[model samples]
Target: MSFGLVARAAGMFAVTNIDDILILALFFAQVRHRPRGVAIVVLGQYVGFAAILAAAVIGALGAGLLPESVLPYLGLLPMILGIRAGWKAWRERHDAADGDSPVGERSDVGILTVAAVTLANGGDNIGVYVPVFANSGTSAMVVYLVVFLALVAVWCAAGRFFATRPPVARALARWGHVLLPVVLIAIGMLILIEGGAFGL
Candidate 1:
């Protein structure tokens, strides 16, 4: 039971970071320099994430979206995602030196762009969590939802705060950008290992 809960949480975290690309792009937009616009983007992310959670819950209640048998296989997705993230990080680092900004390097994107990017990324979260929630027993559903939503809220709040600051924001924009891919890869590999993909 505790193991299932942990598995679901891992799935949610793995999928959620897919939006970092969009968020990264938004930081380069001047809109991020303005508190109001940045807040809107953050709010948009919350709305998108909340919707995914609601959708997952509905899917879970309606039908078994994630059977216990499938949990192990689902765990392998993070490892694949992580590989892509690492690649993206390397690509961005190289591009930056050449004055070629990665997609997330723009800060001038409007509400529509931010919303679109966030929603698209949110779709990945839906795919991963919905199945896990569907297989989760009633005893664990609420716990999973609460943890997932809380994490989303915290992420948005912290993101907004950092988006509004300059020095901290710049440092994140510079150094943290590279770390994002590395973290994504690490999370993916961790999930795969937990899922027993390596048979260790």
Candidate 2:
């Protein structure tokens, strides 16, 4: 409710989660044509972020639901998902070349997949949020949660806007199958390196 509290919460979320916009944009691009794609993406984001917030809250309460070391291992989730997407794309390409059928416009990016990726990508967020939440009062924590959730919607809308731009959309639509796996793997590697996972 206090302006300072709101600002602090907003700043924390923005600083910690800025990378999410690009990831959401990529997801939006991949699923743009599906009737319920946007809804699914939003839902997936919420689900993932809810998990991150839960962890932070638990850590603030000194419960330590997951050890900090384990966060780096979460990076493996995205890497595996990337490999799976790449394999699927390869199979689809092979099928197309064999005249089995034209490759469909649809994507296999599902809500759970998006949620998993988001959660995996939020390792740094957990690290930052836990301490901040612990230092704050219950009311301040409520404000932070509200601001963070509100900004999630804002982030999703902004991502959709960028992804739907004519040029960007065309590029993504044309090469998204190839690009998605690369992006996912790169993000996973970045997370691992940042967290010093597997000794980098």
Candidate 3:
């Protein structure tokens, strides 16, 4: 077992946007109408992340699509994702009308909708995590999966907790579009910096 690899995976998990996972959980909470559905969504997200991590590791090692030396370029992905998220947030913030109830205004979110939104929001996090997975071997991958799932579970629980309250739920729904992107952008920038971009 490589302690360094485990540490890197944990570090990458920490700085990435765990909040969007919550937003996704909130969307699931709204759609399922049952509080337990949030758990289902959380499970799905872990499965999806595990698939992504496996792909990154296998593809990098087997096909060599991602060379170990090129891992630093993963930093650029977060920068781009950050800028894209900031742009989307700015657009939504400016486009919405006054007195518009954001979350309550659109309550008919479906499973596919939640999935698509979750995947879009996960871009930066995926980019950061992929590189880390590529650097590690089997044992590190297991550690990564465990830690990532645990953190995601915690975040989803928080989202579901707030989503159960009418007032808080409404507030989240309204500001979620505006807030989610901003948080993602901030996290993306941090990932870029930590991924060794400054030395450039």
Give the winner by TM-score. Answer: 2
lDDT: worst 10-residue window of model 3: 95-104
User: Candidate 1 on 46-164: residue-level lDDT in tens?
Assistant: 66666777776776565454454555555445445556656776776655445443334664655556556666666645545554555456777777777766776566666656655
lDDT of 1: 0.57
Instruction: State the C-alpha lDDT per candidate.
Output: 0.57, 0.71, 0.57
Model 3: lDDT to the true structure: 0.57
Q: Could you give the C-alpha RMSD of every candidate to the true structure, in order shown?
A: 5.3, 9.2, 5.1
Clashes of each: 10, 0, 2
Please tell me which model should have the higher lDDT, number 1 or number 2: 2
Residue pairs with colliding backbones in model 1 are 24-104, 25-104, 28-106, 28-107, 29-106, 29-107, 29-108, 30-107, 66-135, 78-188
Q: Which stretches of candidate 3 lie over 4 Å from their true place?
A: 1-11, 21-25, 28-39, 55-68, 95-117, 136-139, 165-200
- Candidate 3 RMSD to the real structure: 5.1
Which predicted model would earn the best lDDT? Answer: 2
Off-target runs (Cα >4 Å) in candidate 1 are: 1-39, 54-67, 96-113, 123-141, 175-178, 185-199
lDDT of 1 at 17: 60
